[model samples]
Structure formats: C-alpha cells, structure tokens
Target chain A: MVDSGRAPRRGRPPVSDEQRGRQRLDISRHAVRLFAEQGVAATSGEQIARAAGVSERTLWRCFPTKESCVEPLLTKMLDAFRTVLHAWPPGVGLIEHLRTAYQPVLDSSSGEDVEAVLAVVRMTHDEPALRAAYLVLRERAEETFTEVLAERMGMPPATFEVRVQAATMNAVLKVAADEFARETVGRGITPEVLKDHREQLAHALGLVTRRLSGTDVG
Target chain B: MVDSGRAPRRGRPPVSDEQRGRQRLDISRHAVRLFAEQGVAATSGEQIARAAGVSERTLWRCFPTKESCVEPLLTKMLDAFRTVLHAWPPGVGLIEHLRTAYQPVLDSSSGEDVEAVLAVVRMTHDEPALRAAYLVLRERAEETFTEVLAERMGMPPATFEVRVQAATMNAVLKVAADEFARETVGRGITPEVLKDHREQLAHALGLVTRRLSGTDVG
Candidate 1:
C-alpha cells in the first residue's frame, strides 16, 4: 500500500487487467518451476522473488509466503472451471456442460501456465504445505460448484443432497484433472488427448451419477 | 524435543492408554473453551498450559500449533464414524450399517469432547485457518470411508467410482454433523434428538444413495 504511491510507474502505469494477469501468471510459473526443481522447504521467498523477476518487496506484497505464490496459479485454474460452470443453462446436464467446456477451459491457459500448474499440483502429491494451499484453493472451487449444484438441483447448498452432489462433482473433477496432468502435462498434450478427457469425464460422471442419482438430466 | 523430566506429570503416572486419551480430551476442551471465550488469536499457549494444568513445554509437545489443539477432539468424532464404517459386514447396505452404528458413535464421546468438537467445527464456517484444519480432518475421514466403500462395493479403493461415493458419503456425514451440532450442542442434547440423528442420517444417506447409486444392498 505504501510505495505504490511513489515508486515511479514502469511500463504502462500499473498495467491493464490483461497485463496484471500476465504478470501474476509469469510470476507463478517461475515460482513453480523453482519449486519443482528444488523442494518447497529448500526454496526461499528471496529465491522466488529473484526467479520471478520482481523486487523482494513486490514479491512479498503479492504473496505472503512462497507457498502462496502458487495460489494465484491455482486461482487461474479455479477461475477457468467457474467460468465454464457458471454459464450452465438449466436444461443442460452437468456432465454434458462440463464435457463441452472442459477443453476450452484448459486451452484458455498458456502452455507455460499449464505446466506451472501441473508442477505445483505434482508437488502437492508429496508436499504437505503445498497440499494445504492446494486444498484451500479446491475448497474455494467446491464452494462455486456447491452454489451451482444448489441452483441446478433446486436445493439449498447446505442441504445434504445438494452438498453431497456438489462435493462428489468436485471430487470427480479433481480426479479428472489429476489424471489429465499425470498423462499429458510433462509428456506434452495434444488436441486428441484433450478431447479424450471429454470422454473420460463423461463416462466417470455418467457412472457416478447413475450410481448416485438415477435421474439423468441429459 | 521437550524435558518432561523436570515438570513431573501430576496425575496417575503419565496416564494409561485410556487415561492418556482422557487427558488429551481434557486439554482440548480447555483449549477450545479458551479459544471460543477469548478468541483463538488472543488465547495464548501459556494460558492453555495453565488452564489444562500442564507445563508450557508439555502443551508445545502435545500440539505443534495452537489451532491443532482441536485435532484430538475432532479425532474423537472421526473415530466414532470409522468404528461405524469399519464394522459393516458384507450383506448390509451402507445406510443400514450407518443407522445401526450412529447412536453408539455419539454415545462413545464424553459431552465435553462433543461440545469442544462442535465449537471448533462451527468456527470453521467463518475461520480460514481453522477451516483448513477441519477440512484436512474430513479428508482423513474420507480416506477411511473410501476403503469401506471400496470393500462394500467390491471395487479397488483407488477407483473413481469408489472415490466419488466415499467423498459424497463424507460430505453427507459433514452436513449431518453440522446440522446436528447447530441444533443440539448449544441448546443441549436430548435422547429424543440424539436418537433422531439415526433417522436424520438414515434419511440423508437414503436420499443420497438413491440419487447416487440406486441398487440398495439391504
């Protein structure tokens, strides 16, 4: 809050929305790359600051901790999912909407950003601190899914039926994302592999939905 | 890491397995009370150490963080659920097993433990740091449920179907507990209300299973 008042504006006056998003994404990718190369414990905030090409002060201003540097990246992923989720029309089934939008959601992010996200996620499989950050991001995503599920099913988000459905959907999506990351993120993703996710998600959702609720909205 | 050598444990030779559990529960109740009464931020580990009648060193030994002081109380509630989930035989449906086990689960914990757990969980609805801890507990519980769901359904524990069902059941259980806590813990629990939880849980599970997986085992 302090030095932003007088640091002498650099390159486009605090940046446009697009420019800010680019900066955050760029910083996250650099932070995640360093995290992947070196474990979370060994990685320092100063290292992250240098890797991200921001002043140490700016880095701290953006992220309270080195672990939190991954959060904006996770938020980018969450935002993509929410963008797809919130646009659902009542007539379309959840899985159907998800299947159609799934490719676009991942495609929306640049390759560097996607690689950074997967690196952070892969780290979460082993890192406790990062897992905490990852799960909190997921909790935020779950809230979005919960609200949408409530609306779609005509129930309060607090009600057991809606909540279970939402939580289950969130689980399904996480599994889908994890699987996709495992298969393609490091090896390189193709348009074909991306489309394959549509089928995988649909089948998983369809099986789970039939087992969970007999009614097929689609 | 700590010198228990100097402070001489006051009660009954450092407690038996059963007594150790009681001591932990007692400490947690005091911790939760101070957390609720004075606020988690304002409440000091020294204060908890004083109230629970343990050395400052012992408090640090027991709980790595002040917030984690709630873990034992949460574990008591989780243990009850796992005891119910684990004992499911091959023939019984999930809901039937849950209904039979629900009453015994709550009856197992002391009133103080139950209230402490409820206080922590209610605070989770508003507190970010505590909510992360609370969700982590649920994640642990979900792992337990996943194994049970896999066994009951004759699937691998890691399979998508089993994972989704387990996560959904976990969500349903959280909702039931939250609803139960809001209704009874503050006002005081009654036999009628406590017994009614079986009905409440049964109803939630029945609706969810029917919605999720239509084939009833019972």
Candidate 2:
C-alpha cells in the first residue's frame, strides 16, 4: 500500500509542483482576507480553510501555523524583486535596469495582488510574528542586493564599500515601497502612482550608488 | 482619604526625576539579565521583579507588560542618538558631527551600558516584541535624521529628498550598528574597534548624503 503522506505511486498522476505552489498561495490569499476583515486573533485555521474551500487538514498541511499563511504572499513580493534583479543585464546602470525590469512587473501585477501586499503591510503593524517574517525577508532582500551590487562593482560582497552601498540602496527601496504601500492603503493605488514611486526609488538608489562608487555613470 | 495613585504633596520630599528614570533603567537592566540568562518565555514577571529588587506592584507601575521591560534600555540608546542630533551645529557636515558626538559618548559610556545595548541587540534576533520595539526606535531615528538633513539642506523636513536621505542614512547606521553588535558579541568590544566602527558608519552615511543632496562636501 502506498503511504498516504507520500506522493501517489506511478499508477496515478502526481500533483505538479506548480499546482501545489499555487494552491498554497490561494490559501494564503484567503487567509489574508480573513485576517484583514477580522482580527488575527479572531481568525482560526478552520476559518481560513473554509474561506479557501479546503479542508482543515489540508490547510494545516500547507501552513503549520496561521501566522505563516502570510509567508507565501510576502515571498511573492520579494521574489518579484529578485526576478527583476536577476534579469538585469551587464553594463546597464542600476537605475535603468530597475526601471526597465521592475516597471513591467508592476504593470502586469493585478489589483488583487496589490491588495494582498497591502494586507501584509497592515498586518505587520500589529502582528509580531508577521513583523518578524517581514523583517527576515527584508534582510534576505538586502543580501540579494549586495550580491548583485558586488557583481556589478567587481568587488567582494564582504568589502566595506560594496556592503555600505548595498545597505543604502536597500534602505531607499524599502522606504519608498513602504511609503507607497501606506499611500495605497489610504488612497487606492493607481498605475501612475506606482510608476512615480518606482521612478523615485530608482533615482534615489542610483544617486546613492553613484556617490558610494564615486563614479559618474549618469 | 488621600488618593494613593497621586504623587506626594509639595511639602513632602520629592523623588528626583533623574532618580526615577535611573530606577526604571535599573529595572530594565535586571529584566534584560534575566531574559538573557533564562529564555524570555521561561522568565515571569515575578521573577523579573525579584531580579530587579522591586515589588511586583512597582514593576507593574513602571511597565505595562513584561516584554516592555526592554523599552527603557532601548529608549536610552535611541535617546543618545537624538541627543547628538539635537546638539549638531549648522556648519558641520554629517560625518564631522557624527564623529565628534559619537566619540565622546563611546568614551564616556560605562561598560554596563554597553552590555545593556548588546542585550537589546541580542534580544532583537529572537524576540518579536523586542524586534518591534527596536524597529519603532529605528523609525523615530529616521525621523530625527530627516530633521537634521532638512536643517542642513535649508529645507523643510517634509520634503521628499530629505525623507529619502534620512531613510538611507538610517539604514546605513542600522546595518553598521548590527554588524558592530554581532562582532562585539562574537569577539569583544574595545575602544579602538568601537571608534573605527563609528568612523566607518559616519563615512558611509556622509557619502550617501552627499550623493543624495548633490553636494560636494567630501
């Protein structure tokens, strides 16, 4: 007999990895809606599962705890940024690369995705567990920026100037994104507003990188 | 009957405000020691009060919750930065002001104060509540930097450039401080090393500020 915990044997079709990831994200989206509507404390695993039209057992299997349900959504946002950086071409300046790659993603992402991001932001204000998760993701994002920056600068990520520039650049992006999220929550987000925010961030980070590198690429 | 909640009459000897603040800090120091020696979850309010040599009532009066015990120490460190910013001269640039103000504080702070700072840093790694406290302190620090940058640029603090500069500068200082704290814990903190770290942070922030401001300060 095949173990229930393990994947189905060769006789039956197995669940695709992409399908599983999507399902997890679907659950997270529903969980966030429930959290935003009611308080986190008032929401439960069963409620989240029902909202997503899944069994409680499946919800538990997907997320060990309710607090972790937000991870998939948060990770999506970070992953989008990483994808932008990864596709950045050589010899292209930082601002130009960010604008070209990042703009496309912002344009393609739907209104619901933006709402999910806002939910995560609002949750971070009161939920300590969620806040920790968000901060850890940010720390990892900074490290990712450091690696990309080092590659661009022809220096080790551990070098002082590279690390400093990475930190400053990371800070500028974060502050700009946070400000955008805050504004989005207060006044519904629009394409023009997001474009403006991205431009400002790219410009600010570009300025910092130029100064730290002591070069005039612009 | 007199109200027990109210302060003593004017004729009676009054507890000096400085003495009261010190008392709160003393409680926080002990609370941190208890948290470090034993895990936060394992430690209780009664134990913290006992460790602090204060009655439970007094502990409750000072702090609304057990997690808040770290606030006093965290506030002290943040206040130190604010104090330096407040005293900054008009003609001085960011690096020069930081170097001058930071060196004296480092030289004057007692070893115990340094230990307390380290405790807060260590707590931030695992404790969600403490991490929130630390982040809030960082937010305040960013605002303080914004004000300073605005003053230096002869602009209002509400300007976008000032806010972005403040955010970048705050991020640099935070990364540098976290690095220093981790190194201090792993090896040991010495006067020379502390001075070097301060200078590096000042230089990093100065470069970023100059770039953002389009100034030729360096």
Candidate 3:
C-alpha cells in the first residue's frame, strides 16, 4: 500500500496560519511607515514589498490592493476593541466597564504601534483611499457588535434598536479616534494625551449609551 | 467687434442648473427602475440610457459609473433630511421637533417616490457597490450635519462631541431607513408602517442625543 505521494505528508511543513498573519502584519507595518513618510498616492506595492523584504508577488498575495495594506493594523485595533467589549462584566455600566478594561490596553501598547495606528487614523482624515479601507473595516466590525449587543439585550440582531445602538457606538468610537488623531498633529501620544483620549472616549460613549439598557432602550 | 463663437450670441438658452438637476433625477429614476427590474449586475449603462431616453454619453456625463446612478435619489433623501433638521424649531426637544416637522414630510411624500426610495434602500442591503454609493452620500451629508449641530450646540464643528453627535444622528436615520425598507418587503409602505418608522427614528435619535445640549456635552 504505497500511498506516499497521494496521501502522505510533505518533507517541509506548511507555514502556520499564525506565521502568515505575522508576515502580513510585518508587511503592513512597513507599508504604513512608507505611507506616513511619503503619501498613499505616491506609495506603491513594489516599494512596500522592498521595504518589508518580501517579493512583490508575496505582497500582492497578502493584500488585494495597495490601499488595503493598512487593513492588518486597523483590524488589529478593532479586534482588541471587540475583545474588551466581549469580556465586559455583566451588571456594570458599559462606560465604566470600558474605562476600566480598555484604558490599560491603550496605555500598554508599544509606542511604535500606537504611533503607526494613530498615523493611519490621521492619514485617513485626508486620504480618500485609506479612508475607504478604514470605513470598510469599521462597517464589518459593526456587524459583530450588532450580534454581541443583541445577545446582551436579549433582542434579535436585526431589530432596529439593536442595529442603531451598534452603529452609534461605532460612530462615537470613530469620531473619538479622529479627535485623537487631530490631537497628535504636533504632539505625540504621551501619558497625558492618552489619558485625555481615554476620557474623551468615555465621555462620548456615556452620552451615546446612557439610555441603552437591557429592558428600556426604546 | 463680436467674439462670435468665443463670446455670447448663443441661439438657445443654456440648460439651467435646475433643468440639469431635473434631467439627472429623471435619468436616475430610469436607472433605478432598470436596476429593480433586473439585478444591478445585469443592468448596463446603455440600457439605462435607452430606458432614460437619453444618449449613453448623456448618461455617462450624468453619472461617473453605473453604481453611482443611485446617488441622485440618495442625495435627495439626505437633502430633505437636512432641510427638516435645519428648520427644526429651537427651545424644543429634537425628537419632538422631528415628530412635528419631519413626520408630515414622510406622510405627504408621493407614493411612487416613497416606493422608489424604499426600493433603492432595500437594494443597498444586497449590493455592495450601491451600498458604497449610499455610504459615500451619507458621509458627505454628515459633514453638513456636523456644521448644523455644532452651530446649534454652540461648539466648534471639529469638536469631538459635535462630530459624534452628527455621526450618531446620521447612523440612526440610516438604520431607521433600513428598517423601513425591510418592512416594505412583500408589502407596500402604509400609514401605520410610516408612523412606526417615524417613531423608531425618534426613539433612536433620543437614545443617541439625550445628552447633547448647548453647554453640557462634555
């Protein structure tokens, strides 16, 4: 029963999914750095590939378009937010829970990561292509928020109230990000700046969700 | 010394901006009809032009792309919303003002116009290109809302609170429109349905903007 070629393992193991993700993240970091240094219009996939030490083919395989190179970082930020939101303690106000849980993540992120994320956010304010990518990612993330909020409130995901709640929460977060980006124009993200960012977010979230409770949103 | 072709002396009066807008709106209605009859993918620009009783060149001039043919209708909807919001009476609660001032517009809209608008909104739920166009129009409209809300709240347009308020307001309206579209599936918009739509919008707006006041958002 010689099935070596048909069903047996190859000599070299395939790259793990985690390894591929890491490679994509690394490429995204390089692409973002180039975009920040130059501009999105002037940056090219070939330049990003060269900077990331990957072939152009590999870079294309990782991203469908040049503008999408920022998706990895944007998705990472959203994933962190979703993680914090999903782990929110029951019976505690969402604003208070977010203040306690989400603030530390912002405080503890590597300065370089924060800078890159902020730079991408700020660039989105002016770059239409980058703004499109950021918005697409945000819209996709909002679907998950709809599901989570619906479950928390014992309502269907398609209910208008649940849908709007999710949309409003994301809208508040997006505006807060834009504000943070604006604040970082000349000044970098310092402890004081980050704290201000956190408080601004909390204040906005409090205003938005003050009426969203399990029993009485409508 | 007449400049002849370079100067005045046009035989026929130029198409007024209002006439051009009417032409675009007419072309858009035809395009939407074709899209509703056939899927967006199956509908062609030439087909839309034929249905619209115009040259393909005219249709192309009217819309940058086939997907954007829906923009005129979406923009009209946003413009109407802005008109209502701008005319909202002061010293009255927003929800109450919207109910008194905005609900009549919805109730009085011609049935055909409401049907076409609902069809386009419902189609956006399935078509990504149309959704992009819809989102682009909404984002542009939000900028004006930002200005209006900031002025009403006595804050800078770029302030985080005002920006988020504008965004949340648009998000609520968008979700309410989506709900209205969903309700129209297999049935037409009725008085009761439209009333429910108005209440849902007011409720969602109340939830998002309960704390947005002239002096105390922060």
Query: In candidate 1 chain A, where is summed lDDT lowest over 10 consecutive residues?
Result: A209-218
Tens digit of per-residue lDDT, candidate 2, span B1-218: 97775964577677899988998989988888888888777889999999889899999999876877887776666666777777766555657778878753354367787777776787787976566556656766688888867877778997777787887777787778777777678666788778888888787776676643224432
- List the candidates ranked by DockQ, beginning with the highest: 3, 2, 1
Cα lDDT of model 2 by residue, A1-218, tens digit:
86786864677676899999999989988988888888787998899999999999999998766877887777777777777877777656667877767863364366687677777887777876566556655766778878977877788998777788877877777677676777677677778787888888787776666543324331
- Give the 10-residue window scoring lowest on summed lDDT in candidate 1 chain B: B209-218
lDDT of 2: 0.75
- Residues B121-175, model 1: lDDT tens digits: 7887776667777776777778888887777777799886677677667766777
Best by lDDT: 3
Docking class of 1: acceptable
With candidate 3 superimposed using the best TM-score fit, by how many Å does residue A17's alpha carbon deviate from the native?
Answer: 4.0
The CA lDDT at B215 in model 2 is 41
- Model 1 bad stretches (over 4 Å): A1-26, A53-60, A155-160, A184-186, A190-196, A210-218, B1-26, B53-61, B191-197, B210-218
Model 3 Cα displacement at A89 (Å)?
1.2
Docking class for candidate 2 = acceptable
Candidate 3 lDDT, B130-155, residue by residue in tens: 77667766788899999988888878
Chain A TM-score compared with the true chain A, each model in order: 0.79, 0.78, 0.87
The lDDT per prediction is 0.74, 0.75, 0.81
